[model samples]
Target: MVEPGPTTPTSPATPTDPATPTNPTNPTPAPVASPVATNGKLQVVGNQIQNQNGVAVQLKGMSLFWSQWGGAFYNASVVNSLADNWKVTVVRAAMGVEEGGYLTNPAAEKARVKTVVDAAIAKGIYVIIDWHDHNATQHTAQAKAFFTEMAQLYKNTPNVIFEIFNEPDYESWNEVRAYAVEIIGAIRGVGAPNLVVVGTPTWSQGVDAAASNPITQYPNVAYTLHFYAGTHGQWLRDRADAALSKGIALFVTEFGTCDASGNGNLKLDETGRWIDFMNSRKLSWANWSLHDKPETASALVPGASTTGNWPDSALTPSGAFIKQKLLQ
Candidate 1:
C-alpha cells in the first residue's frame, strides 16, 4: 500500500472548476467516446468481467489515494475531469478505514466514498467502493456494515462494485476466504448483484491460492492481484498466469508503475511488461493513485490543488503515463 504520510496538507481546499487538468503541452487530451452504454453494468461470467450485454469488458482508470489522507481528490469535479479528459471507464474510491479514518470518523469517511461513487454513477462509469484496509478480517463487523449500507443504497445501480478488503499482509487464503465468505454474503443479502472483488493474501499477490480453492459460495466474486512493476516481476506474473489458466476470476484493483514505497523512478520496461500481461488477459485495472503527494506513484506534484483539473506542471511522470493509458 502507498503510505499516506510523508506530506499532509493542513488546510481544506475549496473545490475548484473542472477545467484543464494538465499542462498545455499535454493539451488537455480530448475525452474519447465510449461504446459501452450508460445503462449497462459490469457482470462476472466464467473467468471474465463482461458488460451487461455479455461481452468481455476491460476498464482502465485511476484509483484515489487513501480517503482519510487524500480526501482532496475525492470530489465530483475531479471524477468528471478524468472521465472527460482521460476518458477512463472506471474509478476506484479507496476509502481508508484505519489510522484515524473510518473507525475514528465513520460518517465522514463514508461521505468521501459516496462523493466519488455518486460522481461515477452520474457520469456513467463503474466505481469500486474499496474498503482500503490491511487487516479487514479483524474488523469484520465494520466491513459488513459499510458494505451492506452501500449495497442497499446502490442496489439497483449496476455501476457500483464492492471491494471488501484492500491488502492482507500475512493471512492464509483459507482465512481470507473465510472473511470474504461472510462479507460477500452480507453484500448479496442486501440484494446487490454487482461484482465484488476479494483481496488475496500477501498484498493480493496470492491469486494462485484462491485459484486452487475458489470461492464457490458466491457468483460475482473475483480475486484481486495487486502489483508494483519495480517490486513484482515475472515470478508474480507466473503466479497470476497460473491462476488465470485455472479459471479463477482475477481483477487488478490497484497497481503502480513504481516501487511498493510509491516512490521510485518509473521502471518503464517492467511496467510495460505488466501492462502487456493485463492487456492479454483483458483485465480491468485502476492505477494506484490520483493524489498530489510527493511520491513517484502519486501522479501529481506537491502543492497541487485539490481540484481534479490539474496543469501540466502538476502532473508527475506517472500521471502522464496513466493519462496516456486511459486514452487507450
Candidate 2:
C-alpha cells in the first residue's frame, strides 16, 4: 500500500460478537457455505489459475490494508460480512513486516494476520498471507522463518496462499527472483502444496521482466502485478500480455481505483478496462484495501463500524464500485 501522507494510527477495533439468534426463541442458522467448498485447491497452469480439477477459475475479493494500520477489520465478522453480503471469494491479509510492524511486535502482528486467515478459513474463502514489505530481500531470514511456520500450520488446508513479497521497490528481477526462490523453497520444503505468489520489480509492475526469467522449479508458483488504474493504463496491460505470452501466471494481488499514491481521483473508466482485461484472461484479483482510512482507496468512512455490518452509507464510492464488481 502506498501513502502520500503520514498515516494517523487508529486503535484496533474489537472482533465482532459471534453469531447470535435474533430472537431468544429461534436457533441460529448454519453459516452460508463459501467458494472453497467448490473450488477446493488452486493451482497455476501455464498462465491460468485452475482449481484442483484443472478447470480455470478466477477469484474476486478484497485485501485488508497493512496489518499495522488497518487492524480493525481483522476478524470473523468482517470476513463473514464480505462472504455473506459482498460475496467475495477471497481476501488478502497484508501483514506489515517493518516500521513498527511484525519486526517490532511479532506476536501482535501475527495474531492480527492469523485472525483474518482463520476467519477466511472458517468462512471457506481463500486467503492470501502477504508479507507486506517493500524491502523484503533484506529480511530474507525473517521472511523464511515466518512463511515456514505458516506453511507448517496450514499445509493441510487448501484455503491459504502465501505471498512471499508484497512489492519490491528498487530491486531487479534477478534479486527478487533469488529471494523468492529461497522463500518458495521454504514453503514447498515443508510439503505445502498451496500456491505461492512472488512480487515483481519496480513495485510489482515489471511482469515482463519476470516472464523472461520465471521460476522454473516450482509448480504452483505465480507472479504478482499491482496497478492503480489512474496511474497505470493499457501499457501495463500490454506488458502483462507479454508476460502471459511467455506462459507465466500472474495474479493482481493488490490494486486501487485511484492513483498509485492511494489517494486521488477515481478512474472508473480505466478500472473498467482492467476489469474487462482481467475477466477475458480469467485473472484472480484482490482489491487494494478494505480499510476505513481517509483516502480514495479506503472502502469505508472513518466512523464506519469495523465489525462489518456496513450499509450503503458506510461505503465510499470506491467501495461501492468494488463491491459491485465482486458481486458480478
Candidate 3:
C-alpha cells in the first residue's frame, strides 16, 4: 500500500490586476515568451542533451507525484527550492485518475500539469509530463485526445517532454508497441516534435524489454525504464548492455529504495549497483519521488502515512545518493 504525503496547499488563483483595462482595445498585452527554445526536436549531443546549442547537458530533476488524485503541490517556495536551490533540472508530473478510473477532465488536468510545468520553466528547468497509470483499460480514445491536445499546446515549446504512458505492466510487448505507435502517431500528427518517452511492458521496470526492441526508428523518442533493487537488478544490467550494444538512448526514469522483488524496501547495495550502472552509461534519470514518506518506502517524504502529512526529513540515504549522482 502506497502511503500519502503532506497535503500540498492549494494555490491562490492569480488575480488579474484590477487596474488593468478589461477591453481588448485597452487591454494589457500577454507576457512575452522566454528566449529559451520552446519548440522543435529536443537537441541531443553525444550522449548528453542540450537545447539548440551543442552543449553537453544532464538532467538533474525531481518527480512530483503529489498532483495525483487532484491534489496540488501548491508551495511555490518548495518548487523554487528544489529547482533553483537544489539545482533540479526537470520535474516529472504524474496525472492521476479522476472519476470512473479514467484520465478524463483534460482541461483541469492540463491546468494542474501546467502549474508545475510553469514553475519549473520559470526556474529554467525542464518538465516532463507523465500520464501516470499502468491499467490498459484506462487507455481509451479520450486519453489519446487529451495527449493530442497536450502535444499541440506544447508543440512549440522544447522545455516540455511528453511521456506517453507511465509503467505499463500486464500487457504484452506487441500490445504496448501498438499502443505506443498509435499514441505517438497521434502526437506527431499534431506537428509537435517534442521528445517522446515510451515505457516498456511489466510496469516499465523491464530493461530487457527495452533492450530487446530498440525504439530508434521513432524521431526524438527515448526508451524509458524504471528500476527498484527489489524487482530489477541483473535484468537492468542486461538491458543496459543491450541499450549500449544497440546504440540506443535509454533513460532510467524512476527508481528507489525497493529491491528487485518489490518485497522489503531500501536495499542500499542494490541501489548502489544501479547507480553505478547509470553513472557508467552517463544515462539520465529521475528518482521515484521527492515527497517525504518512509525509509524503505518509495515516497521520499518521511513518516508519510497511508493518509497524512509527509515528514520534513524524508530524503533517505537512497534519495541522497540520487541527489548526489544527478544533481550535478
lDDT of 1 by residue, 216-328 (tens): 99898888999998898999999998898898878999999989878885786888789888988988899988887777898788888676678878888888887877777
lDDT of 3 by residue, 1-328 (tens): 1223333333222212111112312322222442233322355443345456554445656676535432334234455666644566667876654432235455555566766665555555667878776664356566588779777766765667887777776877667777777788888898878778777777775546665665544576776778777666786678667665665566666666575432365677887787777767666667766654333544444433322233335556655666666555
Clashes of 3: 26
Residue 36's C-alpha lDDT in candidate 1? 35
Ranking by TM-score: 2, 1, 3
TM match of model 1 to true structure = 0.91
Q: On lDDT, who's better, 1 or 2?
A: 2
Per-residue lDDT of 90-160 in model 2, one digit per residue for the tens? 99999988987889888788888777877777778999999999999999999999999888877777888
| Candidate number with greatest TM-score | 2
Ordered by lDDT, highest first, the candidates read: 2, 1, 3
**Candidate 2 vs candidate 3, lDDT winner:** 2
Residue 241's C-alpha lDDT in candidate 3?
Answer: 75
Highest lDDT scorer: 2
* lDDT (C-alpha) at residue 268 in model 2: 83
